[model samples]
Target: MKTLQKITVILTIGLALSILVVFFTTSNAVSSGNETIIRFGHGAAESNERHLAVMKFKELVEEKSEGKMKVQVYPNEQLGSEAEMIESVTFNDLQMVAASAFSQYDQRISVFELPYLFDTYEQAWQVLDGEIGQEVAEPLLEDGLRVVAYFENGFRHVTSNKPIEEPEDLSGLKIRTPEFPLSISTFKAFGSNPTPMAFGELYMALQQGTVDAQENPIANTYASKFNEIQDYLSLTAHQYMPLPVAISEEFWRTLTSEEQEIIKSSASEAAQFHRDILRENEEEMISKLQDAGMTVIEPDRDKFREEADAVYEAYKNRFGEDFVNNILKAVK
Candidate 1:
């Protein structure tokens, strides 16, 4: 009878130990299995505002998802260039990218490239955060891309070897522009010789006189050290550029609705955070360019706006008046 009791006790203790082992093994498997990984790519260097926003996005997503999702950022074209990144994300080979030149893929995005579009940052934000952004972004879903947020590249300005105080001053000057039709068109309308080139080749293009000038946001100008090669920085504020945070439709479909909302909300918050940093540092950038021996020109903005009529007509013909009007109405 004592021997039987001893056997019973041993069996019970063995079962309890096995149960404990199973529980721990299952818990570890669950912990490791639930994590979803996102591979994000962007063209900006670490010092650029675009990359800074990307870092903020990583933080927000990780915090909100409670470690269920992990974001891995590849900056400075480590994964690929802007256009290449967009293509990868669209096919879902890459989960996400911060895309500045994605208009080449979807023409609807080209609307933001229109010259003299927004007079102020406030006006740009109103349109971007409202119906116009939604209207423009909606079509991207069909192309296997989802615009998670509209982040700022800020208002683009012109950097020249000489002062560009008026449209005539830009005449016949070789200006490097991103390989976008609207960007080329904008400079063409201003009577400049617009050369479409990759961003990586720009500094050399300017130095070698392959291009005489270029246009980008103030933050980009400073980050690229255009002040060293270029003599003048013109506050053209020609295009209030919006860099899209894009996710692949395939990857997006895999996410739960709750995960999607967390990502979307995180992107929007990061965008605002980026814009605030840019605004606070804009004057400082301009000052730094001046300190670096570049001439800063604040041209008659009205003069630049006046030349945009033909450009507007051309865009209206391409995108339709209704589409253009909707964007205009949003700012008001």
Candidate 2:
């Protein structure tokens, strides 16, 4: 009958329209005007290379998307502590964060932070860009973290009120470290009192004598003007911190496939730019630190390396006795 045919056509057309609406809503998570916004947060100073690279990332993302996407970056703990920002990401309150506090999320990540583990940047990159790095970042995926790029923080060094020529020189001195457990254990092995604190509070803490020393990459030392308060800088190269460009998995799922590709490639390119800047300025920054009146000291590394053995003994069994060695072997 003609009436039956009309009903069948109407049902088919309605179902098709419903399917189209569902697909459009799920495929493109945009605002009313088709604009998507990403709120990115970090705890680095404005002058830090990471911040500079993030600016580049913003530029790249906007340019690639032709203004369809926007990135709003908050630096210098403006979004709160690293832990708070990470928590925000999990709940989808924040879209992205440059996560430097890896050890806090997973202890397996801190294995890379062990003393004397990376003798050169090349070795560190080899492992990070390979399977080892993928495996480490994998655990956090379960917690709603998705790593898009690895941003470099460079090798950490010690800065104190007095010269640090050996572990004995550091004896009894309270050294400021991140809440990272490996760093605390490493400093303890070197016979120094490790006082864990946030990076933003470090300068005032040093000025007020709350902590006697701190270790960081040369770039961070210079950016923080550690020379103004700390009188000595030692090239400890204890830990190579490579931060992650982390995005909330929930937020990521909302991005269209094209938008996701733009974000990922932009982050990767920007991070590479940051790594190159640190590498190019490694020597220049040290010279500038010396010029700023901080005495630069290169202590006997063999003695420091020897002391690091204790740190390995402390965490090896916990991280799988062979885990550390396997990473070292890959880089070698």
TM-score: which candidate is best? 1
Residue 146 shift from truth in candidate 1, angstroms: 1.0
lDDT of each: 0.86, 0.86
Per-residue alpha-carbon lDDT of candidate 1 for residues 12-109, written as tens digits (9 for 90 to 100): 99999998886643212222467877888898888888888999999999999998988888899987778888888887778888887666666878
TM-score of every candidate relative to the true structure? 0.88, 0.87
Report the CA-based lDDT of candidate 1 relative to the real structure.
Answer: 0.86
Total backbone clashes of candidate 1, pairs 3 or more residues apart or in separate chains: 0
**C-alpha lDDT of candidate 2 relative to the true structure:** 0.86
Which pairs of residues collide in model 1?
none
Please list the residue runs of candidate 1 whose C-alpha ends up more than 4 Å from where it truly belongs after superposition. 1-32
RMSD for each model, in Å, please? Answer: 10.1, 9.0
Q: Give the runs in model 2 whose Cα sits over 4 Å from its true position.
A: 1-32
